[model samples]
Target: MSIEIEMETTTMKIYDTEGFPNPARVRIALAEKGATNDVDFVAVDVMGGEHRTDAFKAKNPDAVVPCLELADGSHISQCTAITEYIDGHFEGPSLTGETPKERAQVSMMNLRAENGLLNAVGAYFHHATPGLGPDLETYQCAEWGNKQREVAGQTMSYLNEVLADNAYLAGNKFSMADITAFAGLAFADFAKVEIPQSLSNLNAWRAKVAARPSIAG
Candidate 1:
């Protein structure tokens, strides 16, 4: 199905990092929507502490990646929000969902994966393990981080089971939920977490999603 929206043609700017999962999620969504070419990619130096600078904070108070700056001077932060905007405003296959029910299901699944899995992995990396850089001496959340990693791993196992009977998280059709799942799972690889072979269905689905031109690009 085709969607039509009467919006002016203008380049959207995306602030991203090279290996960051959150930004990659938005990139893949844009690729799925055929909106990549229309976007101006701006690399953010996460290691250089650019995100915490006053300039970056002005764009996103949270100082997170995958921030989308629309031509209308509106800035969008968070992968889910940016993906939904692209899916809603552009004319093409809908990434969020077509019907209200489908939309709700996809949104719910996406949130579950994010909160249960993604956040867990992030906690593991940021608090439990001194990832990217050494933990700041002032950081006092180490204990919680270790606990979060265990929870994240358990959630991943649960998600693998959930994907066993379904071709996609929401249904057979690809949606933003898939994007979030792929991003979260892929990031786990960096932290030396491997998907168990028992989750064959998830592995198969991930392979298919990764094969998309958007993902390859």
Candidate 2:
């Protein structure tokens, strides 16, 4: 896709690593909003410690991938913040939410998926497994990592329970919460965290989300 671009405007810039989980979230949001071609993408050499550099930190204190730079040169980091910008700026179905209740619900579910699943899996990968190798993973806490792995599994089960009644996270809409949870499951798969065979609702939800044009295409 194509999103109609305003005249004489500089395309916004996105600094990210392709195929990485968090970056994929923003990419999906862009695709969903039909704004994939509206911005310029700048690849960050994360494995080379590019994100940790002082220059990169100037753009984003967190030094994370999927950072968004506005046409005027202001920056927004963190996938959630970046997605919020995309959702509000671009014309499409709202990812965060459209109303007060919807927004609050989406935010709550997103955090659940982020903290309990995605971040939990991340903790396991970075702290327990040989994540990003020794160069980037300077500190490791195997015990804590192992504990988070259990949390990830438990979150998966919780999501399954939620999915039992709704089509997506935060209710019938495929909001930002769904995106975060989807990415979390993908991360879990990459980290070799076993998703139990019994969570049929979660598995079905995953299959549906995966088939969306933004992801399948």
Candidate 3:
């Protein structure tokens, strides 16, 4: 006999952007956990200052990308929070982890990648490039931006070294940590930051992750 599993459908409103990293991370996570169709996509134009508007700030005071507005009028900011919620509530594969030890490892790796690698890249972009052409003067700290780029490059090298033997950043399975790293790395490319060819393991792993339908979606 075959057993069928039923999953409750949940509708979510996602405030996102097409080429942004933070939003893409949440989008990719939703795809990995098969929660894409459950969400209503709302594109917030970051370049147009939509996120900085009062209306957007009411939903998220931080005015950050990838805000999740629930049907209950509750809002959740931060890509990690949204992904974690989906991983916990969704009925498919758990991206966070199954066991206590596994969860800890996954969280640890994910945090490291976000803080050390992703944040560095963000700093590089905000301070160096500042795609906000007219608002470029808002970030003229070229010295700081250059420093951040170097830091991010170093962090990528470190991550590549650590991921040499591991199939994924957290451990053997493809968890949220890998997703975070991939989003960060992808964003870095747009920022004109190049990942060293020496990071062959990371490149290989990225290729594997990129092949996922969710990523393509």
Best by lDDT: 2
Question: Which ten residues in a row are the worst by lDDT in model 1?
Answer: 131-140
TM-score of 1: 0.90
When summed lDDT is taken over every stretch of 10 residues in candidate 3, the lowest stretch is 130-139
Winner by lDDT between candidate 3 and candidate 2: 2
The lDDT, on a scale of 0 to 1, for candidate 2 is: 0.95
Off by over 4 Å in 2: 1-9
Clashes of 3: 0
Per-residue CA lDDT of model 1 for 1-217, tens digit only, reads 9999898768889999967989888888888888878899999988888888899999999887879998987899988899999998777889899999999989998998888777778877787676767523236387987787777778777777778877889887889988888888887888766667777777888898889888976
Which candidate number maximizes TM-score?
2
- Residue 168 CA displacement from its true place in model 3, Å: 0.2
Q: Rate the local accuracy (lDDT) of all candidates.
A: 0.83, 0.95, 0.86
Instruction: Give the winner by lDDT: 1 or 2.
Output: 2
What lDDT, from 0 to 1, does candidate 3 have? 0.86
**Whose TM-score is higher: candidate 1's or candidate 3's?**
3
Candidate 3 is scored at a TM of 0.91
